[model samples]
Structure formats: structure tokens, C-alpha cells
Target: MSRVDLKVVLLGNAMVGKTSLMERYVHDSFNCNRPYQNTIGTVFAAKRVQVNDVTLIMGIWDTAGSEKYDAMTRTYYRGAKAAIVCYDITKSSTFQRAKHWVRELRSIEENCKVYLCATKKDLCDEGFVSDDPDIQNVVERYASGTQTKLFVTSSKTGENVVELFDEIIQDFISNPENLQKVEEAIVLSKKTGERYCCAI
Candidate 1:
């Protein structure tokens, strides 16, 4: 089978469950009772999945969400094929931070697919119900305006975690135009002597 490689980044504020999401998707396992510790810089994981006749190796980066590591995190955004900007459904502030993550990803990687991920769905009894209409409005508006996919996922419950990555991979496989754009971007970056985070 033909082999392809892609980079995916997860971004959000601290305690937004970015690490848990990555762990769940990459390993199909998560520890619900684990103590929370801030990601100092970034963590990397790799997973391989077959889409059609192609074997895709995804290099997933779980970036640090704290302000101290913001500079370090920005370096990993370049040349990513997809970005998951995650937020805690129970915390409106994380949702707002997710928006900022989206903007940052766009500014650095224009052609990268951005996914608005509402994390920790298990905590919400009704699965992402928000009392604030403005929060919903902002999330919907931003996603629509940016033409990004939005997903509600729970790392603890394994809800939609695999589905999210599968959807992204399938979308790329189905859309030749998008795949071409990503390839062109990679070539352009190489020609300009710019380094892609997951270049290999």
C-alpha cells in the first residue's frame, strides 16, 4: 500500500483535556482519575490508519496550553495538515480560548483544516448544553465563518474521539483538491527554506 504522512496538532487552554483527547484517540485508552498536570512543552504520538489504498501515518502533537509555553507551542503549528482546537464544554472560558487557538492556527497554517472540538462531554449531563446563548452563538458563528468542522468528544468515555480523526482522514482522502493544496503548501514551504514541524 502507498504510504502518506500527515501532522495534526491539538490546541486549547490549560485543563481543557487536550492531552486526554490525544491519548484517547491515539491509544484508545484514557485514565479518568489521573491527576492533572500542565503540559510543559508538547507531546508527540503517532498512529497509522488505512484510508482506501493508502496507509496514513499521523503525527499528532499535543501542545502545551499554558501562556509560558505559548512560544514553544507556536513552533509546532507550522505545516500541520489538521488542527483540533479543543475546549471544555463546562467552561465557557475554554471555549473562548479555543477561538483564539483557531485564529492562531489560521494565521500560521492557512491551508490546515481546523476542527472545533468541545471536550469533556461526559461532564455535561445533556452532552454540551450551555446556559449561555452567546457562547453557542459565538461557537457556531466562528465555525461557520471559518468553514471548520465542530465535534463534541469525551476522552473518558471514548465518545467521538476516533470518529473525529477518522472524519478528517476520510475528508482528505475524498477531497483531492484539499490534498493537493496541502501538498502544494508543503512544497512551497520547502522551497522557501521554511521548516515544517513534522517534516520527514
Candidate 2:
């Protein structure tokens, strides 16, 4: 089997549906009333996304969005092959939080592929969204990236979730040199202490 190891850290402010997005994508279901769970440390989920002949294993680390847990988050980003900085379309602050994560990832990941995701499209689609400029401004900031095709997603209605990972895998494969860096990072991290990062 052709396997692609893809580790993604989902980052954003609390209550922004980061976990809900993962549940929707990985399980194809969403619960609007699940009790709050503390992911201040980390939460992990794994699923296989098949793209052509490659079996891509996405080790998703659903991370805490609180600034208090920022250091913990950095330690977890050690060997991430990719990151999906998710934000809530209805909440502009979450979008800013996503931007912060992008900046942090840029420093830690030498060659990690990344995507910016806007979760909870249901809010906007259902007309319960806020009149927030963050949504429009964030989209504009990430337009080129999302266009070159490293951009936004809505896991609620299954938008771009599959395509996002597909593009990451294809992009990584297209750049063999970068893929080597990814593999080396993973191996070295494992040899040390990083078995895997949390993706709650």
C-alpha cells in the first residue's frame, strides 16, 4: 500500500467548532449538543483518506484554542506534515486566531503543507452569522494561498475536506525534495519522543 503520513493540527479559538468539524469529516456526522470537553492538553483522531493509489493517513491533532495552552501546542507541532488552521466563519476573532496559528506553524514547520479552513459554514448558510468583517478580510488575506490552492474549507457540509487533503498529498508528492524533509522530520521526531501529536 502506498501510504502518506499526514499530520494536521487544527487551531482556532474556543467554541469555533474545531472538534465539530473533525467529527463531521472523520465520522460524517455532527452533534449540535455535545457537552464541552477540555482539549487544553490535546486530542487525537486518525482516518485514512485515499487519493488515487495512495493511502493517506491523517493524524489530526485537535488542539486547544486558548492562549494559555500555546506552549503545549508548539510542542505538539514538532513533526506535523501539514496543518489546517480552522476558524469560524461567523466569528471574526476565530479567524484571527487561525492567522496566529499560521504564523506559529511557519516558524516550526520547515516544509509542512498547510491550509486555512473556515468551519461552521452552516451559520452563514443558515443566516445565523454575525456581521463580522473578519470573514471577508480573512478570505482576502488567504485568497492567493487558498487559490494556489492552499485555502479555506467547510467540514460541516463536507466542503473541501477531501480536496484539501488530496491537494496536500499531491503537492507534497510533486515536490520530492520537500517530501524528504517531511519524512526525515517524522523519523527524527519519532526516534526522539514524539510518537504523535494530539488532534482533539
Candidate 3:
């Protein structure tokens, strides 16, 4: 089987469940009671998936969301093929921060496929908080404008995590032109001496 590699980044504000979503999707496991530690710079994980006739190795970079690490985290965005911009459904500020992340990603990697993720759906379902229409509209507008998809996910319940990645892989596989763009970006970044944040 021929193997293709794609780089993906997770960007959002602190404590917005970026790591949780990543862990759930990559490992098919969730730890609700696990002690939370802010990601220092970036965490790397890889999973191989089959998309149509292609075997894709998704190289995922779980970036630190703290402003203190913004300089460091921004470096990982270069040449990324896709990005998942996550926000806590219960926190309005996180959603705002997610928008900023989306803008930053677009500025840095314009061709990168972006996915706006409203995370912690289980908490939203439990009455901790309800979705705000204004925020929903903002995300919807961004998704529509960017020509991408929006997902409401719950790491605790494993909702939409797998489906999100599945759609991403399928989208890439089906779009040969975009896949070529991703490959070209990787080659150009390498030629320009850009650091590779995640291994393929």
C-alpha cells in the first residue's frame, strides 16, 4: 500500500480540550478524571488510517494554547495540511480565542483545511451551559466563508471525533489537487529550512 503523510495541528486557548479531543481520536480512549497539565510547547502523535485506496499517516501536533507559548506554537503551523481549531462549548472566551486561532492559521497557511470544533459537547448536554446563537453564527460564518466544515465534538463521549478525522481524510483523498498542494507545501518548507514539528 502506498502511504501518504499529512500534517495536522490543534490550536485553541488554554483548557479548551484540544488534548482531550486529540487523545480521544488517536487512542479511542478518554480520561475524564485525568489531571490537567498545560501543554508546554507541542505534543506529537501519529495515526495511520486508510482513506479509499490510500494509507494516510496523520501527523498531529497538539500545540500549547497559552499566550506565553504563542511564539513557539506558531512555528508549528507552517506547512500544516489541516488544522482543528477547538473551543470549549461552555466558555465564550474560548470561542473567541478559537476565532483568533482560525485567523492566524489562515494568515500563515492559507490553503490548509480548517475545521472549527466546538468541544465538550457532553458538558453542554448535561446542562452546564447551552450554545449561544451568536457564537454559533460566528463559527457558521467562518466555516462557510472558509469553505470547510464545523463539528460539535465530545471527547468524553467520543462523539464526532472519529467522524471528524474520517471526513478530513476523505476530503484529502478525494481532492487530488489539494493533496498535491499539501505535498508541495511540505517540500517548499523543507527547502526553506522550516522546522518539522511533527514526524510523519
Candidate 4:
């Protein structure tokens, strides 16, 4: 089987469920009773996914959301293939923070693909995410303007969790050039003995 490596980073405000989302996606488990704990600088988890003949090994990095770590968080963005900017659906402030992250990621990593993720979807029983005027405006006017796709996910219920990651993997594999670029980078890294992960 052919192997493809992808580095993905999660960026968002504190308590927006970045850790929970990562756990649910990587481990397929959710700790509902777990106390809130801050991610110190960055934490990583790898999950291998099979799409057709290619094996996708995604190195997902979860960064601390506190403002104090803003400087350090940007360091994790280097060489990232994709970024998931997360926001809590129930909190407008978190969405605003998500926007900032999107902009920052775009500004820094111009080649990186961005996905806007709305977390805690299970908490919102009102209607679809589009029903929220503020979120809809941001999704359409702001997120769409950046060519970002939005996913409404609930880590608690496992809703849209697998679909979200599947879509990401598909996007990477759908393009022949994307896979070529990854292969070329791996070759170059090996030749130069360069370290891509945890070098910061």
C-alpha cells in the first residue's frame, strides 16, 4: 500500500472543545466526565486511514488555546497540510476567535487548506447551523470568502465526526498533485535529514 503523510492542526479558543474533538476523531471515544484541562504547548496524535490503495497517516496537532500561547501556537502551523479552525456553536465569542485563527492560518500558511468547524452541535437543538444569522453570515461571507468548508460536528454524539475526517482525506487524495507533493517532500526530508514534527 502507498503511504501518504498529512499534518493537520486544530486552532481555536479555550473550552471550545478542541481537545474533545481531537480525542473523538483519533480515539473514537469521548470523556464526558473529564475535567477541563489546558493543552500545555501542543499535543499530537496520529491516525491511519485507508482510502482506496493509499494509506493516509495524519499527524494531528492540538494546540493550547490560551492567548498566552498565541506566539507559541503559530510555531505549530509550520508545514501543516490542513488546519481545522474550531468554534463552539453556542458561543459567539468562540466563533469570533475562530475567525481570527482562520485569518492567522491563511496569512501564515498560504498553501494550507482550512476548514471551519462548529463544535458542540449536540448542544444546539434550535435548528441547523445556517439558522443562526450570525453564524450563517460568517460561514457565507467570511468563511466562504476564504474558500473554507464548514462542518457541524458533535464530539459527544459522534455526529459528523467521521465524515469530517473522511472529507479531509478525500480532499488530499482527490488531487494527484497533492499526493505528489507529499511524496516529494518526504524524499527531500530524508535526503536532507530534516525534521518536520516536534522541531519547535
Candidate 5:
């Protein structure tokens, strides 16, 4: 099978469920009883996905959302091929913070494909999120302005999680330039004897 390696990063504010989303996607399971704990640094997980005849090993990086790790989190943005900027549907504030992450990613990784994800869809369905009309307005406006794809996901139900990563992999395959960049980065890292974070 043809093989390719891709780097994807998850970014958002604390409690936006970035970690849970990663777990659900990578492990196909979610822990409802798991206690809340701050992700201190970054967690890396890889899954091999078969898209047609190509095998894509996605190295996903889940970064800490605490403000204390803002600098450290930004460091991981260096060579990401795609970034899933997530927010909680129930909290409009999380969506606001998500915008900031998107801006940072655009500035740092101009070529990176960004997906604006609203998390906790189940909460929204259960009327947990307040009637924040402004939130929808803002989300629509911001996503349009940035020309980013938007996805509503529920980690608890495993909704849209697989589709999200599969779309990313398909995008990588469809874009020759993206594939070339990853290959170039690998070659350069080999020469320097360093680990290559795939080129953004």
C-alpha cells in the first residue's frame, strides 16, 4: 500500500473538548465518567487510515488549552498540515476563543487547511446551550470571512469525527502541492537528522 504521513493539530480553549474529540476519533471510545483534568502539554496519537489505495498515518497533536501553555501550544503549530480549531457549542465564549486560535494559525501557517469545529453537539440538541443568537451569527460570519469549513461534532455520539479526518486525508491526497510539501519536509529533516513535523 502507498503510505503517507500527515500532521494534524487540535486547538481551542480549555473545556472545549479538544481532548475528548481526539480520544473519540482515535480510539473510537469516549469516557463519560472520566474526571476533568487539564492537559498539561501535548498528547500525540496516530491512526492509520486507508483512503482508496493510500495509507495515511495521521499524527494528531492535542495541545493544552490553558493560557499558561499558549506559547508552548503555538510551537506545535509550526508544521501542521491541517488544524481543527474547536469550540464548545454551549459556550459562546469558547467560540470567541476559537477565533483567536484560527487567527494565530493563519498568521503562522498560512497554507494550513483550517476547519472551524463546534463541539458538544449533543449538548446543543438537549437545549443545554442557551439561546445565543449572536453565537450563530458570529460563527457564520467568521467562517465565511475566513473561508473555512465548519463542522458540528459530538464526541459522546461519535458524530462527524471520522468524516472530519477522512476529509482531511482526502484533501491531502487531492492536493499535489500539499503532498509535495510533506515530502520536501521529510527530506530536509532526514538531512538534518531531526524529526520533521510535516510542513504546514
Candidate 6:
């Protein structure tokens, strides 16, 4: 039996609802005022999705979004297949910090799939809907420059969140050749009596 593994991590400034979005997917429930728990290093949720004939086992890691834990959190980025950089639409400070996280992820993973998400849209005014020329312009510039897909989502309303994961899994399936390469490398490394980290 062949199993495909994926690790998705969320990175951003604190209080952007990263954990809330995660819980909504993993548990199908939401809490409006749950106490914020700092993920000391990395806390994870796992789910398996059936994509056609393949089963993708996704492991999502939620990182602590605190300045004091920055050094500790970077270690969790290692071996990630994809990442979602989240920011609060109402808070420009958190929005601005997303670029730094995106840059850091790109530096380590040559082709890491990066998704730029604007969280908490329910709080923002429709007058400021991101599709507006001014807003879309900003998102476009940032996404293009950073090599990421910019998307506006409301985790509270259960919007676009599922599509985000669907697209990511589709991208993985689109590359059938990579899976064979991964398996081949795994077999070769095992015979050599050692492990190679970069092959995946």
C-alpha cells in the first residue's frame, strides 16, 4: 500500500485565528471566544482525504505566533509540503507581517505551495471588500512579488477554506511523477543503510 504524506503549517502574527480555522476543519465546530493557547513549539491535527484513487494523509501544524517563540517555531517549518500564511483583514499590522513569513518559507522550500489568507472577513466592512481595485491591487502585488496565491477567506463563515485544501491536494495529484520519485528515493536510501532528508 502506497501512502502520500503532506504537512501543512499555518504561520502569521498572533491572534489571527489560525487555530480556530484549524479546529473548524478538524472538529467541524467553532468557538467565538475561546482562550488563546500558545503553541509552545507546534501542535498538529491530522486528517485523511480521498483524492480520486489516492489517499492523502494531511498533517497540519499550528505554530505559536509570538515574538518570543519565533526561533522555536521556525524549526517546525522544516519538511512542510505546504503552508498557509494568515493575517487579520481588520488588523493591518498582522497583515503586514505575513510577507515576512512567506519570504522565510520560500527561502527554505524551493517550490513550497504558499497560500496567503486574509482571516476574519466578518469584521471587515464590505466597503473594504478585497475585490475592489485598490484592495485587489495590493493583494496582487504582494502575491506576485512573494510567489504565493492571495485569497480572502472568512473562517467564521466557513468560506473558501475547503477549496483551499482542495486546490492544494489537486496540485499534489497533478504531479504524479513526483510521487514515483519520492518512492524511488525512499527505496534507494533504505538500501544504503541511511536516510536522506532532501529527497522528499
RMSD of each: 6.0, 5.4, 5.4, 5.0, 4.8, 5.9
lDDT per residue, candidate 2, 1-200, as tens digits?
22226777777788777787777767877676668775677887887655554444677789888889988888877787777777777777777677777777777786666677777666677778565845666577575664423445566677766676667677756776755655675566657765433322
TM-score of each: 0.81, 0.76, 0.83, 0.83, 0.86, 0.80
Write one digit per residue (lDDT tens) for candidate 1, span 73-129. Answer: 889988888999998877888887888888877787887889999888787755566
- Name the runs in model 2 displaced over 4 angstroms: 1-4, 145-152, 177-200
lDDT of each candidate versus the true structure: 0.80, 0.69, 0.81, 0.81, 0.83, 0.74
Mark the 10 consecutive residues where model 5 has the least summed lDDT: 191-200
Between candidates 2 and 5, the TM-score winner: 5
Candidate 5 per-residue lDDT over residues 1-200, each given as its tens digit: 22237889999988889999999988888999999888889988777766665445688899999889999998887888899999888788888789898988888899789999888998878767545756867897889988998888999999998888878888877898766665675576567776433222
Off by over 4 Å in 5: 1-4, 180-200
lDDT of 2: 0.69
Instruction: Please identify which of the two predictions, 4 or 6, would achieve the higher lDDT against the true structure.
Output: 4
Which of candidates 1 and 5 is the stronger one according to TM-score?
5
- Candidate closest to the true structure, highest lDDT: 5
Per-residue lDDT for 38-154 in model 3, tens only? 999999888876554444568889999999999999899888888999988877789788878888887878878899899998986887755564776776787798776899999
Q: Kindly indicate the candidate among 2 and 3 with the higher TM-score.
A: 3
Superposed Cα deviation of residue 119, candidate 3 (Å): 0.3
* Model 3 regions lying over 4 Å from their true place: 1-4, 130-134, 177-200
Clashing pairs in 3: none
What is the TM-score ranking, best to worst? 5, 4, 3, 1, 6, 2
